[model samples]
Target: MRAIWKGAVSFGLVSVPVKLYSATENKDISFRQVHAKDGGRIKYQRVCSLDGEEVAYADIAKGYETEDGEMVILDDSDMADLPATSSREISVEKFVPSEQIDPMLFEKSYYLEPEKVGAKPYALLRKALEESDRMALVTVSLRNRMSLAVLRVREDVIVMQTMMWPDEIRNPDFGAVDVEDAKPAEVKMANMLVETLAGDFDPDEFEDDYREAVEALVKAKIEGGEIKAAPTPAKTGGEVVDLLAALQRSVDAAKTARGESSAEEPVQTSSPSKGTPRKTAKKTATGASAAPRATKKASVKKAPAKTAKKTAKKAS
Candidate 1:
């Protein structure tokens, strides 16, 4: 892969020359809007909102709008006058625990590879960071914009992950939420349910079921076959009247489904009889005087054991 950025990892007074390449990729299929009538490709043109006239590339200029519709246009030279640090350095500011960073702030990640002469130092730094379990906060300028990024060891390689600013995240405020007076029992039950369903996060087990279904439908259409829709699962019955009873029932069901009960313990049933075959109870050993039946028929042949007494009797 081609290097997207060429820079140096700067820490204290030391700088390690490195090259950055994207570490992840997206493989999603994309479609473009088209004109169906004439089968002509649709194209977009930039137009001035005030005049409603199409604007050429050369006619466009960056402008800042002030109060009362005042505008200040900035030319290329004016933009160049703005203070910008060199793009050749990834200036490290501080070191922090990787877990301290929120996942939402992460924007993109890139693998950092050292140049030929900097290989030894790169490997040493990556190993040291891996042992220390800390990430470096760094600033990198790319495409005329500066971004806050984290530098850390990804296995044997160094990785740089760009982060978004805090202001970009939307504030959480549940509008019109009716929580004036929630019942204590309801809250307790909800908490219990959540606790019961809690588990370690594993990204591999989750999938986009809707997207897969849509892709399957598209494939079927392309092959000139009918797409069969999956039947919707039956909706669960209404909420139970007793909260504790429901929770206990749910716990019991989950345990039974997972076969957590002992082999000797009989499973309790709450189902109504609907002509289903019932399992016959096994008879206790002492319940009846009947002897255990032999598995083989009485006429089956058996091998005779050799005995000293039998041999003596034969001699006599």
Candidate 2:
């Protein structure tokens, strides 16, 4: 990769010259706006609001608008005197414990490659950081702005990651929600469900399904092949009054998908007698049980009388 910046890291009396290269890249597909009828790509021009005329790129200068609608235009000469604008050093302020820095504050990352003359000092710094388990807080200037960044070791290389200011992070302001605490039974079942699905996270096991589908669709269109519309998926969402039952169902489904027996899920069976309470029963190893059939027959025998009474009430 090509280096984006060349600078020296100054920590005490040691100065290590290094080149910075971006550590990550975007892989998203891009598309351009076009005319629907003629397939011509759309283009835009920069027109000034005050003059109603197109402006050239070189004529554009940075401007700041005041609260009362006054524009303060800044030229190259005005920006040349800004602080840190001409600085070529990544000045290390202090070494801090790595855990003290929040991961959310990190913005961009770059790989630091030391020059031939400074390689020994660079290795020394990396070794010190690794042994002390600390990160070096540093100040850097990029694109005419001073930024706070941290230097840490990744594998055998030292990486510099720019950070966002504390004020840039917004505080969460969600109002109170009226939700009841989960019951012990529900929490137990939820724990079971979690255990059934828990495993080490391997990024290779997941994929960008939407991107793959889009590529397949485009390939089919290019090859003049037939395309079929996918069926709409059934929705499974509503007010959940029985959280424990829902959690158990989820655990059973997950276990089944993992090729495990679902017999461990508790089966509820009610007595045949009227006003008798229901009780939990477990299925045998073969998943065969007589309690569920008895409950079904009992419910069937009482359904006709209940239906007749409902019909009579409606008639009245």
Candidate 3:
């Protein structure tokens, strides 16, 4: 894999020169906007409201909008003059227990490979983190913004996981969910369901079914066959009022589906996080299986610079 960014992992006075490569990838069968009738690619123009003319790519500078709708245009030179904490260094602030970092704060992960001269220091930091079981909290500037990231050893190599700012995480205070009642029996049965379904998180076991189906559909269409609708999961019976019964049935069903014994043994109930919103599945014409895929697609967006993207563009 090609390196996305070239930088140094600041270890005190020592700088470990490293190349950063994306540690994760989203495999989605994406389609660009195109004209339906002519099958031509749709393009967007950067039109300026001040003048009725299209802005050239290089001429397009960023503009910060004020509350009263005034645009403050910032050119490359102006942005360059702004202070950067560390433009080309992953400056380690401190090391903290790995578990202390919230998984929700994690945004993107990158694999750090040592440059020829920095290999020894790189290995030293990696060994230290492994021995202490701690992750180094570091600040790195990219795309004109500084992001909080953690450096941890994955196998022998150091991996950096960027995080969202604390303020970025929303206060999930939905009043409706706060008032939802839970019975002891329902809670007990739900925990049992969790226990039965809780196995190793082997990502390889799950397939990108939607992407595979899209590929199959394309192939079938090319071969002069009818495009088959995506496989819809079998619809279950409607929701029952008895919460305990529903949980028990769900546990049994999941066990049966996994080819395990449908036995209802004593189980410890884990109370859901206080005030956390529960996702209630709704029956639809298509299936709920598409929801996860749609979420991934929704995350796809474009951006600007300070001036670079840490992630690579989708390879054609």
Candidate 4:
């Protein structure tokens, strides 16, 4: 994969020059939106809201609207003044236990590769991180935004996981709900169920059944094959007559399904190829296409054509 950013991991006097590449990639089946009637790709244009005219992409700027209904436009000059934003250096702030950092803060992960003549120091830092069992907190500026990140050892290389800022994380106040607490007997049954189904997480053992199913559907459409509706879950009495009985049945069914297939969760997502956003073409004022055109042709030099007929036609 191509490296998106090139920078160094700076800690004290040590500087490990490295290239950053995305560690993971999305593999979900996807689709492109098109005109339902003609199958043509849908296009959109940037338009000025006030004038009702198409606008060019270059004319657009980042704007923040105020509560007083005023737009504040910001350009490159304004961004350049931000703290450590344009800095390419991933400056290591400090070292802390990896567990101390909440996983929710982590956003994107990148694989760090050592550049030429920087391999030795890169390996040194990787080894040090592995031995210490701690992750290095750092700051990286990407795409005109400054972000906090953590550098950790993964395999023989160092991986940087960019984190969300504290302000970006939403509070759990929206989830304030009070429900009946679990009973001791139900909790005991839950523990037994967990133990019965618990196993080591082998990522390879799992398959993306949803993606496979979607791909199969796409293939069927292309090949003009028969497609049956997905099997719906067996309906049961809506009322839960016995909570323990329901839990026991679910556990037994899960065990049987586990023995049958490796497919787990059926979560699906769209992953269409990136398409270029439509930009408005400069609108021209005149349109000759709407006006009629004269059909100009050279007739067999109509023998100066019978002056009488030409004169008659001209008169008519």
**Global fold similarity of model 3 (TM-score):** 0.63
Stretches of model 3 off by over 4 angstroms after superposition = 49-53, 57-59, 143-145, 176-180, 225-316
lDDT of 3 by residue, 72-136 (tens): 99998898898765498899999999899989999999999999999899989999999999999
Model 2 lDDT at residue 225 = 53
For each candidate in the order shown, give its overall lDDT on alpha carbons.
0.65, 0.72, 0.68, 0.66
* Model 2 poorest ten-residue lDDT run: 277-286
lDDT of 2 by residue, 161-274 (tens): 999999998877897674478888998999999999999999999988877887878898868855332222223232231233334445544565567775453544533345
- Model 2, runs deviating above 4 Å: 66-71, 176-189, 222-316
Q: What's every prediction's RMSD, in angstroms?
A: 33.4, 26.7, 24.6, 24.7
Q: Which is better, 1 or 2, measured by lDDT?
A: 2
Indicate which candidate wins on TM-score.
4
Residue 60 accuracy (lDDT) in model 1: 94
What is the per-residue lDDT of model 1 for residues 160-255, given as tens digits with 9 covering 90 to 100?
Answer: 999999899887777767885889999999899999999999999998787788788789796885433222222333232123222333444445
Best of the candidates, lDDT:
2
TM-score of each: 0.60, 0.62, 0.63, 0.65
User: How would you order the candidates by TM-score, starting with the best?
Assistant: 4, 3, 2, 1
**Model 1 C-alpha RMSD to native:** 33.4
Backbone clash tally (model 4): 1
Count of steric clashes across candidates, in order: 0, 0, 0, 1
lDDT by residue for model 4 (187-264), tens:
899999999999999999999999999987878896885433222222344233223223333443455445654222
TM-score quality measure for candidate 1: 0.60
